[model samples]
Target: MPSPVGHALGGAIAAVLIAPRGTPTGSGSRLMALRARLSHPLVRLGALAGCLPDADFLWGRHNMETHSVGAALAAALVAGLALRSRRAALVTGLAWLTHVAFDWLGSDDTPPLGVMALWPFDDRFVFAHAYLFEAISRRYWLPNFVTHNAWAVTSEVLMLAPILAVLVWWRQRGAGPRV
Candidate 1:
């Protein structure tokens, strides 16, 4: 299966393309970034919560809907309700869908063959291969999220460093909070 980077990279690309194009505003950037960051932890927790189907805690074999489209959409909608930012929700949804798309393309399995990302909406799924093969056996594929498992819990703290630094700098420069 593809790594989180692969998933997020796909998300980022789709976000760039599908994100609303309007006056470049800090609010938009903040919303997009937060949506992306927030989705990560949410997806992780959702997996742990057993709310996400087809997901195995150790194996990482799960449907894309849990970690991608459905989860993302749910998160975005909640964020939108709380923050009233439609753009944020849009970015989150797009990012999620992008993850699903990438998974479809990169995963060796698709729909009936593998994960069904567009379940309920569609039956088709993109199919590909694992990004990292077993270290001992290159023919076999490795699991995704291995890189982030240890650090997944600290994501918010990790994100805070840069977000705070930027915010403080912006504040010191007399630029008020945009959103």
Candidate 2:
């Protein structure tokens, strides 16, 4: 499956698009302001939520029930009830959905082919093999970090960084914090 870069970038995109944003303290560049804004607790929470569904891998389960739409709905419902804000639930849910969408659109050359996106409802593994994303390197951390994974992640960054830059810049220029 696609690695953390795609997932994290997806979360960052969600944060930029949905989270309340304002100018940051200090005479920092817009990029710096973006970094600061992304550090906000709510933005970070959204970013974290993007990768949270992968936690099912902890028990040797990669993409079964947790990768389903049901899981996203359950997350949104729980987050809405716990956070007492529909906006929070929406951001959290969108962040998670971004991950699933990326995974669904990614190229998965590994066995089992794709994620069980409709698990518990439809047990089929779904894959687009669109190559919009790069597959993770199944090597040791250091080696992978310097090689296939690095290139893959760089591709993700190259694809996303400009969009993120434009989004942040537009948000800063157009208005104050949005709901």
Candidate 3:
């Protein structure tokens, strides 16, 4: 599956696309606008959600319950209650789902072969077989491990960077009233 970096990027992209725009009235520097967007509570929560599925790794369950839609819903509900905002909950849930989406599009070299994305509904694992992102290696002792993972990260950046650039451009260009 894709590395945490890719998952985090996916989450950020989801936030950029789904979270309501909060650009302040009047004009501002592109960097400041981007900063404001990134620092929004919903966006930060979305980014956190993106990497949360991997927390299962701490318990030796990498792609099981935590990677499921059920878990995403649960998370969303909890976030909604805590934040008192349905949109925040939705953004968080979608950001979490981006983790599953990235895993589905990535190569998985380990056993079990795919993510249990439909866990509560169906215990079956699912994989896209698209191989858009390279599988990340956990074997840190291997000599080539660093280089292999570096290439994987580079590929992820290549794929995600353009989307981020476009988001920044769109936000900046649309920050002011259009008339």
Candidate 4:
């Protein structure tokens, strides 16, 4: 899977794109006109969601069931219930799913490759095999591992920078007009 840096960056990028900055002129629905008042906090919260799936590592295994798309949706639903906002569900669920997507596209050199992304239903491990992201090596948390992760972080930043920029531009462009 890609580093948390990549996943959090992806979540930040998604937050900028999905968050409603302001109510557009003459918008009808209340939800459509919403300013997303707590958008700033939600932004950080959404980014945090990207890292939550890895919490599964504390229990038994990594990526077996926690990385599932169904799990992501369940998380979103729980987030909505907890926060009392559908928008919360939307942003968080998608952000969490982005982690799984990154893991899918990332390089995995260890045995029993890929994650059970479709768990509880299909129970099949899947991967993109395109290696758009470098796998994060946490097997060793030593100084050498820091250097190794540094390289991975550099690569991730280089690749994800443009997407983040585009999402920022998109958010700024849509901040005023919804048309």
Highest lDDT: which candidate?
3
Q: What is the lDDT, from 0 to 100, of the residue 157 in candidate 2?
A: 87
Which portions of model 2 show Cα errors greater than 4 Å? 21-32, 141-145, 175-179
Candidate with best TM-score: 3
User: Against the hidden true structure, what lDDT does model 4 obtain?
Assistant: 0.76
For each candidate, give its TM-score against the true structure. Answer: 0.43, 0.83, 0.90, 0.82
- Considering only N, C-alpha and C atoms within 3 Å, which residue pairs clash in candidate 4? none
Kindly report which residue stretches of model 1 are placed more than 4 angstroms away from their true locations once superposed: 18-61, 64-69, 109-112, 121-179
Task: Report lDDT (CA) for all predictions.
Answer: 0.44, 0.75, 0.82, 0.76
Model 1: lowest-lDDT 10 consecutive positions: 131-140
Q: Candidate 3, which ten residues in sequence have the lowest lDDT sum?
A: 170-179
Q: What value does the lDDT take at residue 86 in candidate 3?
A: 81
Q: Give Cα distance to truth, residue 118, candidate 4, Å.
A: 1.0
Where does candidate 4 have its weakest 10-residue lDDT segment? 30-39
TM-score for candidate 3: 0.90
11-67 per-residue lDDT for model 3 (tens digits): 887777766554644438767777777776766787889999999989998899999
What is the Cα-based lDDT of residue 147 in candidate 1?
45
Q: Is candidate 2 or candidate 4 better by TM-score?
A: 2
The number of clashing residue pairs in model 1 is 7
| Model 2 residue 158 distance off true place after TM-score fit, in angstroms | 1.1
